[model samples]
Target: MSSEFPTPGLKRKARKGGPDVPMWAARADLVKRGYEPKTVRLPYRLDEPDDAPLLSAACLRLQAEMLEWSSGHLRDPNRFDGTIRSLSRRYQTDPESPFNRRLKHTTREKDAHVLTLIEKAFGDRLVPSLKLADFWRWYDAAKKPKATGQPERVRRAWGIMKKLRELFAYGVAAELDGCARVRDILAEIRFPQPARRRVTLDLEHIEAFIPKAIEMGRISLALATAIQFDAVMRQKDVVGEWEPIPEGEALTGIVLNGRRWVNGLTWAGVVLDGVTRKATTKTGAMIAHDFSLCPHVQQVAAHVLPERRVGPLIVDEQQGRPYAGDAFQREWRKVARAAGIPDHIWNMDARAGAITEAEDAGADLDAIRATAAHTDAKTTARYSRGAVGKSRTVAELRLAHRAVKNSA
Candidate 1:
């Protein structure tokens, strides 16, 4: 362990013939005790403002696991058997469980976080003795205003309750005792729903974002932004998604970073009519767009040599493969910051911006609905957040009608 660093309990090993800098890893005791990860290599030195928090988080997580292990919560079969913590493990590991087989990798990662919160909340509370009030109590506690003067995290608490409901359903299916009662109780209660998002990404943002992404050599990100804006597509449809590989199966798609990546828009999807046609991942409804009409998509497409247009439309030039997962958004945000886009707007907001722009341009709701492959116009209505622009469009149309009548 090094005394030079502020973070203690990390072991160091000198490189054989590599850099003079030593490789830092978790302490030997944590390794000996068999942490679930078994590997906690720190690539970051505590140099930047962000690095300190990252290192501190690893330390806190390691310490928490160690505390749980020593307190008999993890080690004692008699005290910990059939607890929420144990059930969560089964939910994660069972081959037939939705967590293992059915969930998207991104979803699994998110649920795993919620499950950790659930484990801490319930502790040794046996599923057989659980009550609905327990959940409500957790919800109430979760919604309390923070000491930092922050408002109650109602949305966050709502999400936790939603995941808890799913866990209860799993419990009932698995025949964990008392979950049926709590599940019934949950059915009687209504959870809160947050209002639709109002923030939007517009053309000015697109003009700024694309050129910066291109300058930074993140052409894939640039193209994805353009496609997402022009085509009104989800990031998943544009950049593809990562999924867990089945135990025994061969996939034709790119398999990197230990997951199978599939379903991104391929250059093959770009047809001779200059229209890019592909089925969306979520709704499975096909969307087609003429890239020739979108200058941003057209300009970025020129950067990719015609000879290199054979595979996934968006490839990470740095890795020489498609982005692993969520890395696209991470890199997109970096470009956004450098390009002077506001933090209030997100990469996901690109779709909303496009749709709002369409509404202002007087495009029909049904037409905009097809942009997202949405089944209903009313649903698309919620995402069209530009009231001022839409109002102006309406005003212009009314005055134009009056002028035409006068001329006639």
Candidate 2:
């Protein structure tokens, strides 16, 4: 019987094909030792010195596997034990997972909610076993109204469908089987009809709204409303915290400790003669507006500055911490209710008012875009609330009449 020891002959044959090239051949001694003699090819050049070590390592792995097989301990590493629940958990909690790592905090939070809903529906199902029909069934269930009976809007249904696609697409990226064609198969889904929002707030609503928020001790909300009202900042930006600088400087396109400044006034940046040197944040566009120029906004900001010395510019009064997105919404709801403001006047509509104010003040599209921190002039137009459109129509008509008179 051959000894259960190193096979010198097998090691020698590792380079027999010439100078460390990959070679795999059956050995009689290996077979006689109650093991399968198999060939393994590696992706290393024959001339490389590392190739011999890698080849020997492969041979050793095969021997170990054979020994394990004899001892009934061999296991498949690529086994399909992954299920929807497991994948969702991994995506939701595994810090190393791409879904957790790559997404923003708010985005990850939203994804977690979506994953929870998905798990409640199909958590037990294996990821690789999900078919297009199965996906459609789940999607149909998702679109059904909850106990509240509020009809799920087309936009929201579409968002859920997209997230479902993302789930399967995640599986495919992780090399799971059934997800190979998941996105392509799900592409057959029909888009939900868009619901246009027509509930716009004008200057009067804001003028009536701010005092009520202040009266209810929603100081942060009041300050946020004021900023949004005057500056046209987004709710996210208005509610977002700022990293305080003693010098009042803001650096654009710079991230400090994973945080980016979004909306706030700074007294620093390119000071020139007779020019209002403006600072920019991610939410603030390239051109800066002097908030001091707006006395009403200045008054509101001054009311909040002493208490806003640290942490977020706007904070929860009860917790003394920054308000999470939903907390802010709930707080706003109470404030609006107390103020006798209609439920349909969203906090965001203040931005539309600000944009309209900019238009009413005869500021051009470029000025409004900068003031609103908008990336596109067309987007500024959308929020301009017919102000710019009305002006444009009048100007066009007057020009046409002048041309006709001159020609006559």
Candidate 3:
């Protein structure tokens, strides 16, 4: 109490003659200056050698805080206190969660499904303790509904695991304590990469498809199939709402901005001049195509144009609303069955067919790339089927000629 140097405001009476005491309090002037002077308290006796560093740290922090500086821990509580369940919950519901905000709606839906599977399998498992072997175990046992082979179900489960890898990667970037281990385990567990084998339609299939759809009284489906094949548009573009040009507006031709059309342009309301601007949803790339130049596109447009009134471009004749993507697929399968086309071929194959046709027509890589809105020219190659067969035929001819020359 009778010390040579005493804290400025620390009173002897307030001390109660005990080492355990409030070391500091905020001054009135500091509070008036918008500073919340913090009180530094020690858990143990202040004079104890073991608590000296702790008391010193608290005092330093209090001093720094009064001077408008940060001294306390700044670590995210979620990062330290998190488990797989907590992180998954935050990823789903927390607006501040980065992945929650960044993932697209369709992607978010898939992620939610994956999260459900993960929760069911490893919800209580600590993120750090998660092992690569555990993932393999889960993968081996995972099965989809009515699935016979392990490959198909494994592929589905593998997709969920990959999504979890991405989520854990985000956690690692955020400096979450256990996420690095989870991310690493996910990385080392190698699943078979499924080949991107798409059943691309041929020109003959398209010719047959249209007539059968017409016969089935699915006029919108028939015309939409034709447009999808010719314009290289996605089924979503065909069936989704098209933004029509505003009244008295001079803007003509279709302008797709993602799923929505711009400049009052709707798929049903597209005013075909000689060209149109199409923005693909997958790659978010823009490309120009001549809608009027193609006879197939024009013929389909002529057939559907009269029906494109003031609403959805591809509507149900009965409901007069846009066909849902699944609904359109169902109708397409019916037409394909009636047309004597393979049931394995999807409605989406028409777009692939269009890309193949463009490639077969001697369009350069970039030209076909633009038509398909492929971000990579190499990806445009995957959509091409006819060219491979043609190239093989030419190679066979060269081989024959080489044999002849060798004999001579």
Candidate 4:
């Protein structure tokens, strides 16, 4: 091959008996300098059609790269600049940064989405110069087209502010210009917290939902509801989770849709005598559940299809794969609707409902906390927010105490 037309950071090679056309390749020198997009292949033109526009996405990229390289800003992202965009890029790209190292994969994914928006909105804003008024304006921009009191708008605004807080803290840690003052300003400002969901998956709702789900031929939904309601487990625990398959290794784990699926309640977790043990994903606490404790668990266990008995306890019948986060919610919602479960009662409320039920049944607070796999009793108490049965029990106890006093 011979270079018919030579270009910096690109080249066009020619072969004998080949038409005189340009075939572009990124210069090997660019790779030596660690420039990204190591190779650039310009889009070829169609000969059958008349002369088409020569510009392409690859050409634009090359142009940008050349300009950046000439301007000595090619490695700017690698260095810390006192800009919001620089801080965000560091949080996103640095392998050892808290964003990538400390947070869960799911959490990092959500933060990454917010990071892109943050960069676009405040890319050039310097952290040290960020004021409360300016920050509020940025938040308003995020909540645009959604009015005050809208649940989604407030939730999204809160999420964006939370990410900004984290980034500012990171900037402070890195000793970037003006981040410390901004952090303190953010501390004094009151960001609207997302409203807590008050609707709970009540006992009556659960009872109705389970049989309806089973009758509708969604045994997995029934099993999941039973397990979650009885054991106070998160839906993620029942549906399991999927992890990515590592590169350059033999593919072994449950690889579905090109990702490794693992850790949602596998059949193997269910041991002899109806005792099931699994660790919580959020907290590393090990939970040993005796399915015999809840008759609902036993009922669902008896109805488990033979195939389901071999793999995960709740495999999606349609995909034959462990339920993903969104898919799991959708399927569960469908069965919930069919069961006449109210729209406000989310699948997540099942944990709270179970805790409330235990509290009403006179179960010890410590026991309920352990059942919910919460490290703190206070955390467990939050899940029982919508529980009215416990209040009724308390009212009854007070009346009985009054009666005893009168008799005395």
TM-score comparison, 1 vs 3, better candidate: 1
Q: Which regions of candidate 4 fall more than 4 Å away from where they truly are?
A: 1-73, 144-152, 389-397, 404-408
For model 1, the superposed segments whose C-alpha errors exceed 4 Å read 1-82, 86-102, 128-133, 143-152, 173-175, 388-408
Candidate ranking (lDDT, best to worst): 1, 4, 3, 2
**Clashing pairs for predicted structure model 1, backbone only:** none
Candidates sorted on TM-score, descending: 4, 1, 3, 2
What shift in Å separates residue 185 of candidate 2 from its native position after superposition? Answer: 1.1
Candidate 2 structure quality by residue, lDDT tens digits, 1-408: 023322222432345556553434345655575543344333345445545565455445555655665676643433333456656665555455667667765567677787777767666564434576776676566666765778765565666777777766776777766666666787776656446555566767766767877777777788777767766767765565334233445554424444454443322321112233333445334544455665455555556554445545676798775664378888888888777789988887888878887787777779778777778788888786656556776898999999999999
What is the C-alpha lDDT profile of model 3 across 1-408, one tens digit per residue? 223323333311246555445445556666565543223233334455665554455445445445542333432424323446656765676566665668755567667888887766666454645667777777666645445543456567678678678778877877777788778778777776556756787779888877777667787887778778878887765565344344576654433333333222255456465677756555667757677776665655556545455655566776555653367777778888999998778888887888877776667778778777777888878888656645756788999999999999
Angstrom error at residue 220, model 4: 1.0
TM-score of 2: 0.62
lDDT of 4: 0.74
Output the better candidate (3/4) by TM-score.
4
Please, what is the TM-score per model? 0.71, 0.62, 0.68, 0.78
Model 3 misplaced regions, further than 4 Å: 1-82, 96-98, 143-145, 149-151, 241-269, 305-308, 389-408
Candidates in order have lDDT scores of 0.75, 0.61, 0.64, 0.74
RMSD of each: 14.8, 14.7, 13.3, 13.1
